[model samples]
Target: MADIAVSTRGLVKIYSNTVKALDGVSINVNHGEIFAVLGPNGAGKTTLMRILTTQLRPTSGEAYVLGYNVVSDGDKVRRFIGYVPQEFSVWTDLSGYENLLIYAKIYGVPRHEINERINEVLRFMDLSDASKRLVRTYSGGMIRRLEIATALLIEPEILFLDEPTIGLDPAARKMVWDKLTALNKELGLTIFFNSHYMDEVEMYADRLVILNKGKVVVEGAADELKRSVGGEVVELTVDDMSKTVHRVNEMNSLGIRDVNIDNDRGIVRVIVDNAEEALPVIITTLRDAGVRIIKASISRPTLDDVFLKYVGGKISEEGRLQEVRTLRSVIKKG
Candidate 1:
């Protein structure tokens, strides 16, 4: 328990007696590790982050951050942790240096050490050259880094980031993650984040928990979760969907139990123990069955595949939009 950075027991959050925002959720995150809470839109990721950050209360159950109870010991918990919410929390009218300075003063950093801390955070966030520029003038990624730098001015033991890289371009997202990774490694700071980006979670999170409809559906290291869904995925683009489906059905005899056929795209995705060994045999079988293969590739199972297995769907942009519509409908009915 002492080594655990965060722990929750049967957590639940109900909104207006109609919606169960969190349903008996429980998880543990180890110290000095980057832990990710992942889920689709409206999956209570934000609710959980707010609860852990002492901004919201759970209807039932308990949450501890760095061994401090989030509810009863919120003040102590605040002292030990920093939080960056989904929205940009910065003074856009003020310079980056001024923003950090204000935060340092608010966090009660010693007057003598305020400038030193500001300079340190600016350098760490790679914003030293732009420290005197108004935050409004910064790029989206730079604004995010500035926000993070403000959070770090307090030198908290753990950091909580909610959708930290949500709307940035690929390059900007990578830059933000680079700083986070460095902070975790160099300072041994425990980082807990809520993210929908599977690739980012796969790359940075030491472990992750996937929540759906207010409950955890799966939790593990990225590789462990991927393996749980099965092994490598052998994808083939075939010219004849019917013949390919028939030949793939025969693959069941070869111990390949998980096979998916996308007739629309003429893609066959097969889950096997080893794709490298299975690909040749599969191609030969298809060829012998008079099936023409247009293209074939083998890839290890991805986090998106893991999500699809547990959530029963892809968490794409369209899925997020659907979630929003569904939530609105429920709220209207309530």
Candidate 2:
């Protein structure tokens, strides 16, 4: 129990008697490790985060953070945990230092230590120079770092983030992640987060759980999850997609693992036990069936592939457009 930073058992959340936001979800996050929660829109990612952060109560079951029950000991839990939500929660009208001051007051940081703590987090998050600037003038990534700085004012043991790098460009995302990685390494903070970006999750998370329709679909390290998919992906565009799919599916001894079609692009994706050994056989099979191969490529399964295998679709194809637009609107004014 001492090694576990957070644990949940049979957690459930229901809204309005009709929607079950979480259904019997259970997971364990080890101390000082980076954990990720992944899901499509309406998959209860936020609902779970709200519960763990003591913002929302679970309809059933239990969640424990750092030995404190989130529901019964909400205050104690709050003292040891910090949360950054999906939306821009900072005050854009105020300077970054002012925002931190307000959060410091809310978190009840000692009066004598408030300024020092603010300066420390500002420097730690690389925001010291921008500390006096109104948050509206900061870039999207800077605003996000400020939000993180606000959370860190409490010096909590665990940090929870929902969509930590959403809407930022690649460089901004990289910067945010670099800081987070440093936090994990330097402070040994248990970082639990929800993200729609599978690549980032694969890159940073120590372990992850994929939730869909309020249930846990799969949970493991990214590499373990990808290995579970058990094959290399052979993506090719053929002149005759329908025929290629048919030919590949009809061959039983081809050691093929799965087949899928991209109707819009006319690409047929074949999964096999080994691409190096199977690519030639696949090309030969297609050619004999009078299918013209326009292009072909082979790659190892990715986290997206692991997600689609279990969740039925790529999370990238799901919602989050409006959130990005809102953040972009904020950044445009900066």
Q: Write the per-residue lDDT of candidate 1 for residues 57-110, one digit (tens) a residue.
A: 999999999899999999999998888989989989999999998899899999
Overall lDDT per candidate, in order of appearance: 0.88, 0.88
TM-score of 1: 0.88
Each prediction's TM-score against the native? 0.88, 0.90
What's the lDDT for residue 208 in model 1? Answer: 98
Give the per-residue Cα lDDT of candidate 1 at 193. 99
What overall lDDT, based on C-alpha atoms, would model 1 receive against the true structure?
0.88
